[model samples]
Target: MGTLDSDDLKSGVDLKSQTDDVSLVDERTAEQKKIDDWLPITSSRNAKWYYAAFHNVTAMVGAGVLSLPYAMSNLGWGPGVVILILSWVITLYTLWQMVEMHEMVPGKRFDRYHELGQEAFGEKLGLYIVVPQQLICEVGVDIVYMVTGGASLKKIHDIIWDGAPKIKTTYFIMIFASVHFVLSHLPNFNSISGVSLAAAVMSLTYSTIAWSASIHKGMQQNVEYGYKGKDRAETTFNFFTALGDVAFAYAGHNVVLEIQATIPSTPEKPSKGPMWRGVLVAYIVVALCYFPVALIGYYMFGNEVDDNILISLNKPKWLIAAANFFVVIHVIGSYQIYAMPVFDMIETLLVKKLKFKPTFALRFISRNIYVAFTMFVAITFPFFGGLLGFFGGFAFAPTTYFLPCIMWLAIYKPKRFSLSWCTNWICIFLGLCLMILSPIGGLQNIIKKAKDYKFYN
Candidate 1:
């Protein structure tokens, strides 16, 4: 979405420094060569930094943003705000670290996270670990997208056609997936940056709507405050569980590297300037989008907040329709951004391992089929909120928190017990702690909720 043994390896290998060697240029295998032509154009160097910033912003601020109020409620305002700020600073640092590490290996470009892992760990171990978690986080997020998008569509359906038959969420999921299938034909990750920018705008628009609604409702209702020490306040387990949601809220690290690689860098002029600028701009935008909705939603609804803040509102039909429309559009674009990595991994595997030539028809068919598979799974298990916890705690936390720290340790081998070393381990320890506890909390919540759960309900 986002580690390892030591001692059996070398230190400071300097992947980029080795680029001066004449033999390594364009060292593409036949398989790589074939796939290169088949896949869509992916270089983003010609792209403006604003578009890159938009892509990063949208990728980080999807369904996870909706859960922030609930996360805030669990930890209380003080703790929640503190955690959000900390998560932002730490994740931004790690993201830049990743970008910096990416720059280190100019000799062989790492367009993917697993490739970085392999260089750091010295085997396919990186591939094995990074690939699955990345897929799980991305696909899991996509499933949540469908789930939320279906719910939005169903709401509109009920409003516009008051006497119509009730359709299952599964059908809505299929409809969303069908649309995704059509959009999936657009080649590669770089081409979609503009779409991602538009999606980011939608996200900001809906988030603003949610925030405004929370404020108006908070003003109108004489709701009681549960600052702390209340019966509905979070238990220790709930706090950890909330951390999972918050962790995933910052889970763009998994795709950041992939997005970076798409930026076209010439030998004479590297793309680092635009990349760093874009990343910083993106985080600033993320903070702007996340904090207000969370603070206001928790302020409005307290511990009773819905997993999605939109569903918690009681607004006019027109306003609801507009908000939901934005959400559906945002998720549609978000799904493609996340799914691109998975498609790349599968296509690469097919070409390299099975000796399958990467043809246009094959790429088109395989990717659409993969989209269908994701949709099928979402339809089958529409446990939207529970899936968020599972994916966040199990996949996003490690990818965002644990492994990045481990990778930092491996790459730099910072002075033992120094501040840098201590900080990294602290992050890793926190990551492991959340990884274990949050899932247990998440599962407990899932099991409790499952008692009344029904398929396509």
Candidate 2:
């Protein structure tokens, strides 16, 4: 044979070695080489940043937002602004840090917080701790949405019918449950973004109505329009209640990774840039809508503000009816978005643990069953205030504030007492403090109002 070049000899040896190494790789590892094998290439992956941003906005702006003014009323305007701004900053920072952790996996994407937790800590901790927290928070939120949506629908029904036989809120909730069960059948998170966009608009619509109504009410002769909290001792106790409210308002962190995974990824431009762009734009929109509604609402209602400022509005029946309709629509959409993760987790477990293939019939039946279960819970507890306090105190502090920091430290293992280390520790400390205090405050507040609690009243 003719003398071969040295380059040919080297290439031949490399090819042989690569072929030999292939057998050592596991089937899962081999399948991961083709991203399509793990994740479906669907329209859900084709979302642009603004579309993604709308989902984030819808996720963040929900029933909890109506509580903001009440939160601010407990704390004065100055302190309210400080707490809101600080919460926003800390959440944003932790969110960014989460994205950073997400990128460390090179070609892989984390589609859930539990995945991130598993990678950072261990599979047991991830599956048991993080997963349960997500389920409780998300399921709890869906229950709240149902309760609030029923109230809104009832308000609209009353306004239109004028002395129509007063149907129990349970009837309205059952009606909404039927509608939401249908909507929940939408295949994936990306597909739900369309509904989320409408929901975002609905939230903005009602928020604008509430804000204008508040301004109009405050400007009327004889109405006071400034810092309104009195009863120093009462305010002090309620201030912790406010912390949980604001925390619940920002409780979209559990699904951030799920939303992030919906954006299409390319080798040149990873999901990181798009994720950050979408989140930043969404938060800016959230702040604009949230601050005005909360501030103006508090200014108008003062200490008399209801947990839901919409109820406290002195607007005409038609206007309040319109706002309530919008609230119902927004929550209707939001309930599905939040509930999707729980559905996904359960479906995945069934397929993986029980070897149940993900057929359309299975998916349809399972999701419908899940929706019915949540409806049952909502009907049973009609304890809106208590649920909010319990879920917000128990879940929001840890998921939104505490865990993100610790996860970052666990992943990066930064130098001892370095800026990263110190910052994360401080976050952990603050989160722990909130976790301990908020629940106590919220439980007490709930107890104080327990006598008024009724099931589907």
Candidate 3:
């Protein structure tokens, strides 16, 4: 982030500054025997810097690596590269809109998404655009991670048991839920950030080293094993499917905002510029990481990428070890990042809003209940293909392509309204097209596979 001018220094107010201003503007609400338990927490300080970096990495790492092969197959390697770059550019532009939306508000950055939705687009529209979209998108991400973690679990079972396990996916979900159970309750910001940092580094290192190896091998194959094409299908990308992956890939921006809000300083001139500096850094990182894999995955595997990138790589015995290590790391981090909010929301509803007393027993029960609920998605047992495609194809597009623009327009007042706003509307149109196509293709693919249970069964 960049340093602000003297004027920015004057206006930039953080949580403490907001509270101080509140003391002057409204006295009673500010001084009512207050203690900050952080259950009903304000955004933390210094959060934006780390959050921006973490989310940029997280957004890039999650969907692209594993899902690259599958998405590229439909669109072709060249088109996939084109779309990913295009998406990255569009994503950065829209994210700029989002940041402006936040900066316009001047405080609490995101006090209430719905309220911002109202402010940005007016009451009825914000409710329609911002509220439903965020709720669905956030929950949808939860489901994607659950399913991703479950896929890794099923893969583990195959490795350990030398065969798929009975009630395989259900068992996998349970295992996934068990681990996330610990992470969601954890409130330590630094610990989470540390893990996020390490995971980001580890993922980058492993992916780069492994992908480079794959590229080297690919070069060898091109020269030595020329034209002995493996059996691969011609993938026709349903735009909705591609868009779904796009949305998921560019997510964590919301989480980035949350992290920024939590930073312990006022919204004053930070050590850096919030707009260009923070976002520019994020944009550079994502493009470098995701584009290569999307290209390589398509180049190597054709259409068999499945849900994870490693599947497409199908590396020799050596790289598989590193791949396994990262898959575990991905699942662990994904679970923590996605599920913690669900726990927080549930906590707010139960203990705060419901006026129920917080009890250790209740906490334990709530954790167990949430863990159990994760089962609904995975209970079909040992099935990854159907669920992954269905959600990736269905929910991911709306979450990605459509939601950000909607949220931006709905939440923040714009600088230039008339002609400039049309870009958002244009994005909405494209997003809708994407949402419809991706999910339809994914579900169709899943349905066909399920119907052909003849061989696998």
Highest lDDT scorer = 2
Instruction: Give the per-residue Cα lDDT of candidate 1 at 143.
Output: 80
For each candidate in the order shown, give its overall lDDT on alpha carbons: 0.78, 0.79, 0.57
Error of 2 at 63 (Å): 2.2
Candidate 2 residues lying further than 4 Å off, grouped into runs, are 1-26, 29-44, 220-233
Residue-level lDDT of model 3, residues 1-457, one tens digit each, is: 9988987776765656977877764664343222223432341344656555664465446634556555666565556667787777776776665555554645445534454566756779766765455555555555656666666666655655554436546566667767766665565343466666655665576566545755765742332211222423313434445545555677654444444444454566632255346567766766666767666655665544445666545556346546655666665665555554555556557776686665556666775677666655545423444445465544445445556677666544345656557787777887676666666656756666677554322
Write the residue-wise lDDT of candidate 1 on 1-457 in tens digits.
2132353233324444465353344464442555665554332345666766887888888866877987887788788888888888878877877877776765456778888898888777887888778877888888888787887888778766778999988888888888888888777776787679788999888888888878876643655445343344337667767887888788788788778777767666566667889999999889888999888888888878877887888576677778888888888888888888888788877876787877778788898888888888788778756756866687888888878889889988999999989988988887787788777667767776778878766
TM-score of 2: 0.89
> Which residues of candidate 3, in runs, are more than 4 Å off?
1-36, 40-43, 46-48, 121-128, 153-169, 188-191, 219-240, 265-267, 270-278, 303-307, 358-364, 381-395, 407-419, 452-457
Q: Write the per-residue lDDT of candidate 2 for residues 1-457, one digit (tens) a residue.
A: 8887999999999998877766654554664343223222222576778866887888888867877888887777788888888888888888888766766786577767899999888989777779878887898899888888887888899888998889998988898898987898887877777789999899888888888888876743454534443566666677777877888888888888888777788669988788889899888878877889888887777767888887787368889898889988899888977887887777766765787765778878888888898889878776755666766677788888879889888888999989989988988887887777677767877787776776556
Query: Candidate 1, which segments miss by more than 4 Å at Cα?
Result: 1-24, 27-31, 40-45, 162-164, 220-222, 227-234
Model 2, residue 93: distance off in Å is: 1.1
**TM-score for model 1?**
0.89
The candidate, 2 or 3, that scores higher on lDDT is 2
TM-score of each: 0.89, 0.89, 0.77
